[model samples]
Structures are given as structure tokens and as C-alpha cells.
Target: MSRIAVFGAGSWGTAFSIVLADAGNEVTIWGRREAVCADINDHHENRDYLPDVKLPDTVSATHDPVVAVDGADAVIFAVPSQSFRENLVDWAPVLPEVPLVSLMKGVELGSLKRMSEVIAEVTGAGEERIAVVSGPNLSKEIANREPAASVVACADEDVAKRLQAMCHATAFRPYTSVDVLGCELGGAYKNVVALAVGMAVGLGFGDNTTASVITRGLAETARLATRLGADPLTLMGLAGLGDLVATCSSPLSRNRTFGEKLGQGQTTEEIYASTRQVAEGAKSCASLLALAEKNDVDAPIAEHVDAVVAGRSTARDMMQAFIDRDTKAERD
Candidate 1:
């Protein structure tokens, strides 16, 4: 059995640890809070984040990063995208020369780098040693062992396949891909689209609006990703369309829920104060918009979402902006 180290004790981290252990891997999680670590060790439950789900017996937790990564066959990072650089910098010295997997799905703010890019820069790991997992993975459903499929991407096909085997469980199926850039871009951009969809929901718009935003958002994602040397077809696959659909449509989605709050006339600061979990889209929208602008891609939805998050535009203003834009060919 593989010894897997997961860094992050949040909902996704805990749920994914279950997947690893169910696949016959011995999983150890590194959590920031000693209470969380103790809960997992003593009860096999992360009551703080995933209180409803029970964890596998083979799964455990530690407060020390060294203990988590020591002798691990692979290390998975499910931390927040914004804090990833700081956290990895501190842990890199203790990390073994094993495959590093990223479960994050947001672009870095200042550097505009994908999580895989951040891993390469921070750990100096070659592309082959770095991987990412993404798709229509909603943590609660996965934690409950509901059937789900995802993509495991690495520059090296062999590495991707290996990881594919490591996390393949009865309820979780993983496909492999060599298009890391496409997978990463797909995962990141979908959150922005989900935010827009959430805004539409909050504004009392129905499926017609949601469908329009979802389709247009996929187009925007493909435009930016392909311009940056990703395969265009990848945008049509699980990472792009599948992820966008799930995140935008599901009520359980944090980004969609955050957008719904904004749509219901709540301020970003108010929402931030209310929720303990980070809504990734709320944080990633600005960086995603900046990345699109840098590449000269016209991403109206992302632009409006970023404006709303920055408090420069209300949800009403965002919907109006879309309606006021000049009519053009749908493909344009």
C-alpha cells in the first residue's frame, strides 16, 4: 500500500484522504489545528470541516508536516491557493522527492500562476514530479461516497497513471491526462464562471441565464487556456465543461453560494464575516480577470464578477452591463 501525505485538513482534504485510504493507501493528514489532528486520530472524524462524514480507519492526522510527509509515496496539497506559496516554502525542505499532487483550483494573485506552476517554482520539482487533481469534485458528495469522476494530470503520462491508480476507489474514478496546463486552467477558470452563475441565481434569473453564462464561460476559459498553449479539446473535457456545470449548478458549491449571497444583496465583507470556508471564486476572480486582460482575451463575465467582488459594481450593474453590451456573432 502507498503511504500518502495530505496537507490540509479542510473539507476537500479530509474527503480526499478517505478516497486514498479506501483505495488501500495509508493516508496521513497534516492539519494546522491540534484539535483537528486529535479528532482524526482519536475518532477518525474531522468534526470541524467534515462533521457529517466518517473517515477510514487507515487515515490519520498530524500537526507536524515532517511527520506527515516522512516516507510518503506521494504528497497531496489541498491547501488554499492564496496561502499555498507560504505554506509550501516552509514544508519544501522536509518534503520527500516523491510526486507532489495539487488539489487547489485557483490562480495565484500577483504571479498569476496556476497551482502546478507554484509547485514547480517553490519545490523546484520537474513537471513529471508535479500533478493536479480536478473535475466535478464537490467535497460533500465525494465524502459521502457518491459516485464521482476526476482527472489526474501530470506532464508525464506515467506519473498521471500512477496517481490514477493510487486514488481510484469504488466510488471515485480518475482519468489520466498529460495536458496539465489545460486541466489547471480548466479548474481555475470554472470557479469564476461559477461565481457569475451564482450572481445570476441571486438576481432571480432562471436556467436561461445560468445556461448562457455557463456556455459563455466555457468559451472564455477555452480562449484563455488555448492562448496559453493548452489543448483546446481539454476545455471540452471533464476539467472544463464538467467542472463548470457542476460548480455552477450545485447549491453545495461555495463559490455559487457566495455569489448567491452577493446576489441577495449581501456585501462581500459581510459574506466573508459569515462563512469560515473560503469561497475560492471570490478570491480568484481578480487574478483570473488580470490573466485574461494580460492575454487580451475578452472575458466580460469574469470582468463583471471581479468588479462585483471589488465592490465597484453591484449584481444588478453586472447583469445590466451584459445586457447593454453590443450584439455580435455568438462565437465572437
Candidate 2:
């Protein structure tokens, strides 16, 4: 069995560890807190994040990064998109020569680099060695062994296939793709779109509005992806359309829930105080807006979401902005 290292004890990280173990891999997950590690080892449950799901026995946890990375055939980085750099820097010395898989979905603020790019820059790993796992992967559902499909993207076909084999379980089907940019962009921007859809939902807007937002948001994402040398069709794949549908529709999505709270007039501080999970969309929206600007792409939905999250605009104002836009061809 392949030995896998998952760095992060959050819901997604823990759930992925379970997937690997269920595929017959020996997995060791690394977390910051000693108590959380104890919980995974002693109880086989991450009560704080994934309350009801039980982990497989082959999945364990450690507070030590060295212990987690040792002898690992594949290293999965499931930490927050913002903190990936810091965590990888600390773990770089102990990182073995193995495929690095990113479970993060955010554009790095300031740099606007995707998670895979950040990993490459920090770890000095080549494109062939880095892969990204993304799709409608809601941690709780996956933890419950619900059927789900995701994309495993890398520049190297062989590496992607190897990773596909390692995480392929009956309940978790992974598709391999060489369109890493498409997969990465689709996963990252969908969170921003979900926020917009959530706001529409919170404001009591009907499916027509939500449907419009999702479609237009996807178009904007495709525009950006195409500009960045990605396959336009990837936006229609599991990493794109599939992921968007799941994140926007699910009550289990933290980003959507966070946006719903905002639409319902709760402050960011209030939401942050109540939850331990990181909503990557809230943090990634601004970065995405900046990237759109740099690339001269129009991303009105992402812009509005970023503005609302920054407290510079209100949901009502955002809706009006969409309504007031100059009439143009739908293709434009």
C-alpha cells in the first residue's frame, strides 16, 4: 500500500486521509494542535470539524510534520490557501521526494499565485511532480462515503495516473487531467461565485437569479481561464461546472454559508467568532479581483463579492449594480 502524508487536520484534510486509507494506503495526517491529533489517533474521529464521520483505522495523526512526511509516497497539502506558504516552508526540510498534491482552492493574496504555483515556488518542485485535487468535494459528504468525483491534475500524465490509483475508492472516483490551470482556476473562482449565489439566496432571490449568477460567474471564470492558457472546456468539467453546482447548492459549504450569513446581515466578525473552519472564498475574493484586473478580464460577480466582503458594498447595492449594467450581447 502507498504511504501518504496529509498535512492539515481540517475537515477536508481529515476526510482525504480517510479516502486514502479506504483505498488501502497508510496515511498520517499532520495537524497543529496536539489535542486534535490525539482525537484522530485515540478516537478515529475529528469531532471539531467532521463530527459524525468515523475515520478508518489505517488513518492516523501526528503533531510533528517530520513524522507525517516520513516515507510518504504522496504528500497532500490540505491547509488553508493563505497559510500554505508558511506551512510548506516549515515542512520543506522534511518533505520526501514524492508527488505533492494540493487540496487548497484560493489565489494567494498580493502574488495572486495558485496553490500549485505556490508549492512549486516554495518546494522547488517541478510541474510534473505537483498535482491538484479539486471538485465538488464537500468534506462531510465524502467522509460519509457518499459517491463523489474529483479531478487529479498534473503536468505529468504518469504522476496523475499514479495519484488517481492511490485515491480511487468505490465511493471516490478521481479523473485525471493535464489541464492544471483549468482545474485550479475552476476550483478557486467557484468559491467567489458561491458567495454571490449565497447573497442572492439570502436576499430571497429565486432560482432564476441564482441560475443567472452561476452561469455568468462561470463565464467570467472561463474568460479568465482561457486568458491564462487553460482549456476553455475544462470549465464545463467536474472541476468547473460540477464543483460550482455542489458548492452553491449544498448547505454544507462553508463559503456559501458564510455568504448567506452576510446576506442575512451578520458581520464577518460574528461568523469568524462562531466557526473554526476557513472559508477560502472570503479570503480569496479580493485576490481574484486583483487577478482579474491584472489580466483585463471582467468579473463583475467576483468584484461585487469582494466588495461586500470588504464592507465597501452591500448585497442590495451589488444586485443593483448587476441590474444597472449597460445592455450588451450575452456573448459579450
Candidate 3:
């Protein structure tokens, strides 16, 4: 059995810890909140994120980051995209010469760095030793042991293989990729597009509108992914197109659900105040649009989502803007 340490006791972290434990690994999950830690230790539940889901008693919990990483063979950095850096700094002391894999999925603001790049910067880990797990994974579904698949990417083929071994499960299959940037970008950027699609649905737009946005959204994702040195095919895999469809259509996606609130006429302030989950797209939206503009890539759907979230226009106006976009080829 492997010694696995997971940072962040949120749903993804908790669910992943369960996956490892079920695979016969000794898993420890570190959480910042005392309440969350207590819940995991005492009741085997993460009430805040995955309520009513009982966890394995063998899956331990601690409030201290150091305890979590001590002597771990593999580390899963499962913190939210926004807070990953700061949390890694805390893990550096306890982390041995272990391989670090991230479960985060958003580009860093200002830096436009993929989650893998952020891992390299913060941990001084070689690209070969850093990897990421992402796909059309909806955590709640995975927690229920529903069948799922994801892509694990590393520049080094061996590292990708090792990650695939570590993460593969009866219900969760992981594909290997060398295009870390493409996988990361797809996982991150798709959330914004998912938000826009969900908002359109909430605004009473038909399936045709959703299909148009998703298809073009795939194009924009592949364009940026190729520009950033990822294989075009990876975007068509479980991490890219598949995830976008699921998140855009499902209520399980916090970003999509948040956008639905916006489309349903809730103010941004109201939505933010009403929900505690991290809707990563809200933070990533404008910054991604900025990055796309700098790269001279067209991402009108993402830009429209940003406008609605930032209060530059109502959701209805943003839809109108999409309708008024210049006619173009189906492939473009």
C-alpha cells in the first residue's frame, strides 16, 4: 500500500482520499478548518462539501499540513486553484522527494500560469515529478463510485505512467498525456464556457444555442492549448470537450450553477454571498479573457460571461451580444 497525502479537505480532496484508501493506501487529508478536520476524524464525513457521505475510518484527517505530508510517498495537491500556492509553501517542509500531483484546474491571474506551472514555481519540483489529474470528473459523482475517466499529464512519459497507476481505479480510469499545458488549460478554461452555457440555459436558450457555444468553446480551448504547447487531440479527450459538456449542462458544477444564478437575475453580490463553494470561473473569467486577447485569440463566449459576472451588462444583453457576433464558418 502507498502512503498518500492529500491537501485540502474539500469535496475533491476528500473524495480522492477515499479513492486512495479504497485502493488499500494509507491516506491522510490535511484541512485548514478545524471543524472540517473534526468532522473527518470523528464522523468520517466532510459536512461542508460532501455531506452525508461516510468516509473510511482508515482515511485519516489532520488540521496540520506538516502531519499530512510527513513520509508520504505520493502527494495529491487538491486545494482550490486560487489558494494552491500558499498551501504548497506550507507543505514544502513535510514533503519528501515525493512526486506531487495537482487536482486544481484554473489559470493563475496576472501570470496566466497553468496549475502545473504554479506547482513547479512554488515547490521547485521538476516537470517530470509534477503532474495533474483532470477530466469530466464531477466530484459528487466520483464520490459515489460512479464510473469516470480523467487525463493525467506530465512532460515525462514515465511520470504520466506512474500517475496513471496511482490514480486508476475500478470506477476511475486515467488516460496519459504529455501536454500538461493543454490539459490544464482545457480543465480551467472550460469552466468559464460552462458558466456561459448554463446561463444561456437558465435564460431559456434552446439546445441549439448550447451546442453552438460548446462547439466554438472547444475551438477556443484548442486554439489556446495549441498556442501554449499542448497537443490538439488532448482537448478532444476526457479533460477538454467531455468535461465542458458535463459542467455546462449539470447542476453539479459550481461555476455553471453560479452562472445560472446570474441568468436567473440574481446579482453577482447576491450569488457570491449565497454560496461558499469556489466557483473558479468567476475568478478565472476576466483573466482568461485578458490572456486570450493578449494572444490574439477570439473568445467571445468567455468575454460575455465575464461581462455578466462583472456587472458590465445583464445576462440578457450578453446573450444578445452573442447573437450579434459576426457570422463565420462552422469550423472557425
Clashes per candidate (backbone, < 3 Å): 0, 0, 0
Q: Write the per-residue lDDT of candidate 2 for residues 1-332, one digit (tens) a residue.
A: 98999999999999888889989999999999999999999999999989978899899999998899888999999999998898889999889889999999999998999999999999999999999998999999999999999999999999999999999997999999999999999999999999888888888898999899899989999999999999988899999999999999888999889988888888778888988899999999999999999999998988999999989988888988999999999989
TM-scores for the candidates: 0.99, 0.99, 0.97
Model with the higher lDDT, candidate 1 or 3:
1
Best by lDDT: 1
lDDT per prediction? 0.94, 0.93, 0.85
> How far does residue 126 in candidate 1 sit from its true spot (Å)?
0.4
Span of ten consecutive residues with least summed lDDT in model 1: 44-53
TM-score of 1: 0.99
RMSD of 2: 0.7
TM-score of candidate 2 relative to the true fold: 0.99
lDDT leaderboard ranking: 1, 2, 3
The C-alpha stretches of model 1 lying farther than 4 A from their native spots are none
lDDT of 3: 0.85
TM-score for predicted model 3 compared with the true structure? 0.97
